[model samples]
Target: MFDVEFVVDIINKSGSSVEVKLDDQAKKFSQIGLDSLDMFNVFIELQDATGKEFSDDIVENLVSISTIVEFLNS
Candidate 1:
């Protein structure tokens, strides 16, 4: 199961240039200063760590940390 802290850790470990400090679980990746490339890298890192694939189609819907956590947990 995934949590906000785990998601935040993954984003930080993703090698994204932006620093990760998530106060709101509902905060979108864009609002956190992640560009498309950063998002891609973050997803890849998440897949690698969690052994879960993030399909392209559904990636658009996973805009926030809370959403990602819910998806992973589900």
Candidate 2:
């Protein structure tokens, strides 16, 4: 059920200063101005929203909305 729009919504609501959009799906988190803490919060929010947990290995590669959507659907 996870999609780019869903991911973008969560990212935007995760308290990050930067606002993410569907066009930014291929962009890196850092390129969008998301710091470590922002990413941490995003992940936590994502886990809570999706009712799914990510392992360290998976989290390491989740650097973009495209990847996150792929991982979540996989």
What would the per-residue lDDT of candidate 2 be over residues 38-61, giving only the tens digit for each residue? 999999999999988988988999
- The C-alpha lDDT values of all candidates are 0.88, 0.92
Note each model's CA RMSD in angstroms: 1.0, 0.8
Choose the strongest candidate by lDDT. Answer: 2
> What would the per-residue lDDT of candidate 1 be over residues 33-71, giving only the tens digit for each residue?
889999999999999999998998879899988999999
TM-score of each: 0.92, 0.95
Give Cα distance to truth, residue 57, candidate 2, Å.
1.3
lDDT of model 2, residue 7: 96
